[model samples]
Target: MIYTIHRTNQPPRYRGEWNDTVWQHAEIASIEKFHPQSSAFRPKTEVKALYDDTNVYIIFRVQDQFIKATYTTYQDPVYRDSCVEFFVMPMSPERGAAGYFNVEMNGLGMMLLYYIEDATRTTQGFEKFTKIPQERLRGMTIFHSIPAPMQEELTTPLEWIVEYNLPFSLFEAYLGELRPIAGTRWRGNFFKCGDDTSQPHWASWSPIGEALNFHQPDKFGLLQFA
Candidate 1:
């Protein structure tokens, strides 16, 4: 499964609008491959991506039920709530940079980012991982349909969106200056999860095998930049 990311003439304003002009030109990918561990309830989730000279724009729209979000602080465990994530490896392993960035955000747009070199599970965390500094994340802006600090779960069906733009400079800070993003090929996966929600579920754009893990870079799909 190769997702082709086209270049956008202008960056999208942080509005979380699914059909805005800046996003209409991009292709949409669905997160339909639910993990076996997930509940029977599967929410409809889709993503769109676009790139410009300086940043990459990504947005997720989820038609959800039993929505929940509580963590608001950066680097908090947003995956425990209704979340959407993007794990991207900008540089190929052939270049000796096997690390990838995991951008995890909840419905309220609170996010956690890490550059993971080694994904081996550890008693503490990944064997090799760096939590992205708050200062470096200042360049990114997020827009979410729902506000923050949601403790009560809304059982009614709802549609929500989380959108953000990640500066290329962020990736360069760890992997060194990346070659022109255009025509560059990357490996990545998109995921939707709600570990503590009433209807806990896990789904991905690329089918992750029987293992209920997202850190398997070997299972990532191709991300072709156009």
Candidate 2:
């Protein structure tokens, strides 16, 4: 599965609106596979990505049965709620996908991010996962179609969208400068999970296998430049 990103001269306003002309050209990655071969629900999820010289923009649209968000603070296990994630590794001429980054946001737009060097995830029996302080993410941008502080979970066949921007400079912190010209292949994946919702499920753009895991970088699909 290869996703060719749309290159845009004018970036979107980051308002969770997918009506921008640039987005019309984005290739969609559908999340249809349920993780852990033992599961049965498949919530509808669609994601699109675009990039400019300085930033990579992503948008997500989800059709879910039970949508709930309990955690509002940064890095507070947002994955337990209805969530969408974009994990990416900008290619480098020297080391292949040297390192990757995880940008996860919940239904209410709360997020958790990490620039990983070794794929040693907490699921792989590591202690706690390492993440940059939220203060450092001040430079990043996120926007949700819904207002936050969801006093209660919405279980009425929810449909929502989220849009965010990941500045190229953010990648420079873990892996030096990443300037991918045409034909550069970045290995990454898109994911949707609700570990604590009324009806929990995990889905991915590329199969993450029969086990409950989302840290499989090798399983990531190819993301090529337009």
Candidate 3:
């Protein structure tokens, strides 16, 4: 799907409604959250996105009936808690491998992921880039709050919103001189982890087959730059 931004506006606050069509429209809405049996746990999440000349913006509204997060080293691969993540791949006509960027956020707002590719090498017939920089990573100003007991009672569900702004400059090094042009398409996916379950559910703009993996950009949806 080629998505065009009607305008450049700040993020919108939710008005307490569940409507997928509203999300599918030009406006943003609460994305239907689901849990996959692959992990036996699921969290309710709503996501909305927008794009402009300089960057792409995304907002994720996550609801965790039971909130929990576990922290570890950068590459430790800890999956036992609540966290939100986004994967962005920038595609250029001349480039074979798109620029890979990822962001993962925990309940306490501890974010992790390399925003830039610092090194690359051919490993086992596959090219790999390692040691990306943290400075290249982007983040949201909105912080999730641990709601008070009474507030939790009034709402029944606890929701947290995460916003992001990914700049086009980050792709410059990967693309050399080339840049994303109109009608250009890239692969991407939005994922969430919950309650240290080791299995996280995934929602993507472009659907992959039975096995869900966002690393495959060729299977990603089309993103026509405007």
Candidate 4:
């Protein structure tokens, strides 16, 4: 479903607390269905986002009894574990389009930031699609929770949150230039996947179908700057 991301003049603090006024007012999107559309066991997942001029602030609250994440290094295969992902494609009414960026973080908050030339997860400035250039985002400031490596897989009932302030400059670095004005829309999707977890599941805000591929940008929902 298309989501209108509320514009906030002042985004919420990067802390994990979700009590901020902006979060209270905006509608939270819940991702419940599985990728194949036939799988059962829906996990509790809630996401809220806000965008200002400089950054887009996002928060995710996930509750699951069989959560698992082991990858701690940046750019590692976090999708194999319990992961939350944000794929944003900035658009222009006249220019028509720019590239998209994928910011994926496991439950331990390890992130992999990469720019896609197309829907197939091909990245720029790196020979391998899994390897991202650390030199590009030299001075960009970002934040995430659970910075330390999580040793054990959380099997008990667990509720966790991961928040980030993704800089617009980072998006522009890979996407050329973006002019997000009121009512402008971006093609994107949010995802939670765990290929190697105790309970493997792939859930998304926008349905990804039986392909089980998150790189399908054609099925992405619109994120309007409102």
lDDT of each: 0.91, 0.80, 0.51, 0.75
Instruction: State the lDDT at 157 in candidate 2.
Output: 78
Candidate 1 is scored at a TM of: 0.97
Ranking by lDDT: 1, 2, 4, 3
Better of 1 and 2 by lDDT: 1
Q: Among these predicted structures, which one has the highest lDDT?
A: 1
Better-scoring candidate (TM-score), 2 or 4: 2
lDDT by residue (8-69, candidate 3, tens digit) is 44333333222333334344333333424334445566556555566566567776655554
lDDT per residue, candidate 4, 1-226, as tens digits? 8888888867776677777776775668888767764235467888998888887788988886567767877788788778888888888676766566788888777778877664543345433343357775563444455556657777788777888777777766655667587888889989877777777888889988778688877888889888
lDDT of 3 at 101: 62
Instruction: Please identify which of the two predictions, 3 or 4, would achieve the higher TM-score against the true structure.
Output: 4
How close is every model to the real structure, measured as TM-score?
Answer: 0.97, 0.91, 0.64, 0.87
Candidate 3, residue 116: the lDDT equals: 38
- Candidate 2: where is the Cα deviation over 4 Å? 36-40, 121-129
Model 4 per-residue lDDT at 151: 74
93-158 in candidate 1: lDDT tens per residue? 447456999999999899989999999999978999999999998788889999757769989999
| Better structure of 2 and 3 per TM-score | 2
Per-residue lDDT of candidate 2, residues 1-226 (tens digit):
8889878878877777676777887888898888764236678899999888888889999987677777888877888888999999788877766767788898788988877767654665333345867766766777886676666678677778988888777787667778766777788999999887767888899888766888877898999987
Model 1, global lDDT? 0.91
Q: Candidates sorted by TM-score, descending order?
A: 1, 2, 4, 3
